[model samples]
Target: MQSTEQLDEIWQDRAIESIINFVRSADGDFNCIEKLANAVSDPDSLQKIVEFLSSTSQGKQAFQKRPLLGNIDLQKLHRLPTNSLGYSFANHLLTNNLQPLQRKSVENDYEFFAAHITETHDLWHIVTGCDTNILGEIQLEAFYVAQLYASRFWLALITKNLLKTVIYDIELSTTYMDAIAKGWVMAKQAKPLFGIEWNLLWETPLEDVRNSLNIILPSS
Candidate 1:
């Protein structure tokens, strides 16, 4: 049997290989968004996005935007209004949701991006007004799978939804595709309007931030 240390080394090697493959496969020519848009069903807006990314500098800009979590203030985040969407989402995870993978040890920039995206997932949920219930999560995942070029997001959604169907009595298979379609519509609308600066958002009080950013909250 492999020792724990040896197993960890092997796992780390595999993880590195997977990330390298993902980066090479998706963005090898640095045209991942276009590739993703083409592979999925062609929606006009998505096609427009592809054209925009392909023609303009935004795709490169997005890819170039270095991860911004290095200086986040966890304490300030905790002090935000309890009812604020970000705070509420964080609370839900702390109190009821399962623990996500630890992020501190991630060394590669690409791996860091993947982990960053996973951590901010609830922010997207809040932005989309999707709850964290089984149905809602699957729906949100489908939308994310549709929008993001990361293959892991799509795979995670598929595997998790399939497992939910088998083990949790959730019936998501038939509706997931439709939910993704709807989410794409909403995301297109929302993405253009989402303009919060990372540092300002982290420090600003939720209500003030929401008002300033024009984020609409669902009625409680």
Candidate 2:
């Protein structure tokens, strides 16, 4: 747990390193992403998220209990109905080689804010119809930018990566840009996913969850 006084310095240093790695690849190294999240300090954004969560029944319970997705049972998820979000997420994890999330050290409320967002990263992908590919990763970050009120870290990554692609691979620039645009629209139209109790929804039908959240898959 880092002290409040140390947060600014720590975040700036880590943000710089995270940017360099992100330029080379959109995935941006899992560990680096965590550090970058830890570096961000936005009290207003966090307060708004807290207020949003507090306003809903499910969100209230989620905030009070602080349920973690890591506690999810992979075997049970596998046994869920094929059309269930849980089953799909379990399969997604296995197929994509994505590791279960780990908790970051929380020195204060702000750190906890960072930790919560880090933990929910994959759930966002699951709900947003994004995949684990490079394009999907960038698009997801773009979605977060819009959803989180133009998160600086997410914006920085999206801008840097888009610029890089445009400079070296101009043809692919449109594709990446399109993904970002879709993410922005998708997030804007859908419910805020941060406060969701994903564990409870595992056994529920994926379509139902999507419909409830107003999450529509982009037509191909």
Candidate 3:
């Protein structure tokens, strides 16, 4: 077995290289994303988040079952009732040609926490109405930063992207900041999504799910 220090170093090294590559291309990098998540994911944060999840009845069951969201059938979701969260999410994925996230190897409770967050990431985007565009990504990251406070990777990305935008177009930089502000505010008002069993809510009306979760979508 690898020592914890060795694993941390591996993630950190991979994360730095991946971030650099991602910045150069502006394309999504799954491996890099996972590495970044694991790099900053400390044991304390994991335990606290897990404990929060365990506080709820659904959360306790979620930890025990460890349902993988990626296993959800998009075809079935596409056939769900109109205006259903799952239907909308399925449509979003199909329209964007985005695939479900693959499960990452989880060696411990901390790693499981990071993996769970990564797996449910797109579901958060759907409920929040954030697009898959670059600006949308920054906004969503801002939201995550507000809700989860431990992502140095997001902060770095936000800073670098903001600088890039400022140099490319002053007006666009303003727009990006607006998106970030909205994300922060929306996250502040939203219910914690940490342990939500999204599979159970697929049939729920999209509006109802948003209302229940206190989710405020961004203005188009």
- By lDDT, who's the top model here? 3
Best by TM-score: 2
In terms of lDDT, model 3 sits at: 0.75
lDDT by residue for model 3 (1-220), tens: 9998998788678756755654554446666555555555556565766776677776677677676665778899999998998998888888889787757466665556667777788888888888778788888888877776555656766765776665555778877898899888999999877668788899999999999989988677
- Cα lDDT for residue 3, model 1? 100
User: Following a full C-alpha superposition, what root-mean-square deviation does model 2 have from the true structure?
Assistant: 4.3
TM-scores, all candidates, are 0.50, 0.78, 0.77
User: 54-154 in candidate 2: lDDT tens per residue?
Assistant: 67686666566665655767777888899998898888878777765758355544455466677777778888888778788877988888766637768
What would the TM-score be for candidate 3 when compared with the true structure?
Answer: 0.77
lDDT of each: 0.49, 0.73, 0.75
lDDT for model 1, please.
Answer: 0.49
**Which 10-residue span in candidate 3 carries the lowest summed lDDT?**
18-27
Instruction: State the lDDT at 12 in candidate 3.
Output: 72
